[model samples]
Target: MAPACEPLPVQLGAPSTADPHARYARLREAGPVHPARLPDGTVCWLVTRYEEARKALAHPCLSTDPAHASPKYEHPPWEHGPPQALLAEAAGRHVLHSDPPAHDRLRNLVNRAFGTPRSAFWRRDVERIVDGALARLAGRDEPELLSGFALPVALAVISEVLGVPHALRARLEESAEALVTVGGRPATPNAARAAAGEVIRLMTGLFREKRAAPADDLLSDLASAADEEGGPLDEGDLIATACLLLFTGYETVAYALCNSVINLLVRPDQLAAARASPALLASAIDELLRFEGPGDSAALRYTTASVRLGDVDIPRGECVLVSIQSANRDRCRFAEPERLDISREPGDHLAFGHGIHHCVGAPLARLEIEVALHRLLTRFPALRLAVDATELEWHHLMPLRSARSLPVRL
Candidate 1:
């Protein structure tokens, strides 16, 4: 059993975009879990330490299905309509949000699409895309990394995998941005709704196309699976799943890659070490994920029964926010938690989450970042930041964290 400590008073309004380590350190020192406020003023139990977070995330009693919890515990940006409803209705039929038997079935169907055969094919494709993107960056003096490279690479890879039409990629990009922005205070319900509608329409059309003439891509695999299981998913489920995959698959990798680059450029020695030895790049990537990962918080999990984490007794239906950023840097799990040590041996990190809900795209994400970084370093040996690191803008809202634009001198 994990050790318990005294519960501390919750910090109400810390800046979401600011470095969270200081605040998380305070919380961890005080206890395994404590109360914290969401962006939209929803109060939740912030689970900080690695062991406690893992337990909570994988706890069968804590439900991922939003329907089991009351409205008061709904995720923030409430005005945009219930996220659970939107996910169930617009994105895919049933996905990470669903519980047990249903979750298993849905996950199995999608898992077939991302099997070893698909990954083997994508690995080569990812290498080619990364090499091309880095080559484009070589000629420029100061390239905006996010815009010029990371975003495009991630978008292209996901688009190719999903078999989305080349002509529709621009609209997909626009919709992804709109969807992410919905998490902020200036919520654009109408625009987000429109984007969701467009995504659904586009994916629905693709599903039909695949049903008529199956291809080797992920969509065809999903269509075929659906047919084998009696029928394809309902239109709403299909759309929701496709949209979720489009945004989730690309956004996480884009931000993570950008963060990794920013970390490497800021720490010259680490960059040198990685450049000098390619094998170390994989461990360096793990450290980067722990040090400044793209996800600030895990997807929301609601309590099914009263439970005590450390000194706090969280009641049934209360929301819990697993601070992935904090857990990755816990002093208990890592020595000198705040420092970036590229060569450290990997143990267990929440970078891809844990238990049954672990990120399904972990393999793809790792391949993209590793290939992208290796190619960039090899191509442009003197790559450096264009401006002072402090001047670069950072994204705050949305569960995903990233730099707005990373300007780099190659």
Candidate 2:
């Protein structure tokens, strides 16, 4: 049990990009939870162990709302900007940032677009998008996979699915990058607001366009939603949902591909196994996600009431970050957790998170990875890392992890 008198707060910065799991392992052994201060200077409880983290993520008293943050915590610009800043607020208030009835309402409204049937419908489109990306990747020397292939595929898939205009796609990519930096980097508050504000503005315009001239896409479906399905989304709800979907779909899939690629390249046996067996490939992808999913932690959760987690009591209004990165690698929950074995049974991991707040886009993400990896490996069977594995750099962003670049020779 941790001492009742809390020790000095652990200053939490981004872990070493090269191998963060090592850091998380030490933190888990230290305690189930720690009083920590974020690089941005916000203080919170950091949950590290598997059972404690799972419970913390699912606990109803732990909220995703900024309103529950302690007074000592300085709110981000997106949370309390000017009234004309509704776009910023909306971006901050997306499905990931609400609780209870509001969370349920937003989730239900957004689910109509990402339901199982809709995801199934996306497979052929995803393969088309992947094929097009692969075509562009040919005839390049030492091509950087992150920019050359992975990101473009992810961006194209989301754009096609949402019917984003070609003209707005580049700007959408820029804004999404800024949002990721805002999520993990020590970005200035004003810069964060500007980035989020720009995304909201873009999404707002798209929502209106979809409403005026509906297309057979998710954005159109959301824009033209009627009260029968769920009340029509207001400007804020529409923009927020669009931004959330765009940013999430864009960020996670791109990194997961890069991470999976690097993971396989380092171990040829695993790569050969994945390429040879579709069944093994499916299992391997899940294992890769569990081993190195994009999310290091879920969005910061606020405690609505005092909650006890593994001998430590988190008081009301405090922030809690359940480290998905740590919990998935927990030895208690996984046998020989450090070893990456694609043949093992897929275990429930918090990569997409747990409980009501679990990621709704999980199916689409999986579909994209499966198609992209299959096509990529089959097309370029001789592909190998252009740079030494240790020389590779990772993006040390919180709530996400990915290589900065993956130079490959085809």
The lDDT leader among the candidates is 2
What local distance difference test score does each model get? 0.74, 0.78
Regions more than 4 Å wrong, model 2: 2-8, 74-92, 177-195, 226-233
How well is each residue in 83-149 modelled by candidate 1, as lDDT tens digits? 3345555655456676777677667777777884767889798988888887787678888888689
What's the TM-score of each model vs. the native? 0.90, 0.90
Candidate 1 lDDT score at position 142: 88
Native-referenced Cα lDDT, model 1: 0.74
Q: What are the per-model numbers of colliding residue pairs? A: 8, 0
The window of 10 residues in a row where model 2 has the poorest summed lDDT is 77-86
Cα displacement (angstroms), candidate 2, residue 163, comes to: 2.1
List model 2 lDDT by residue over 224-270, tens digit each: 76333545545675567667777678867898998899998899999
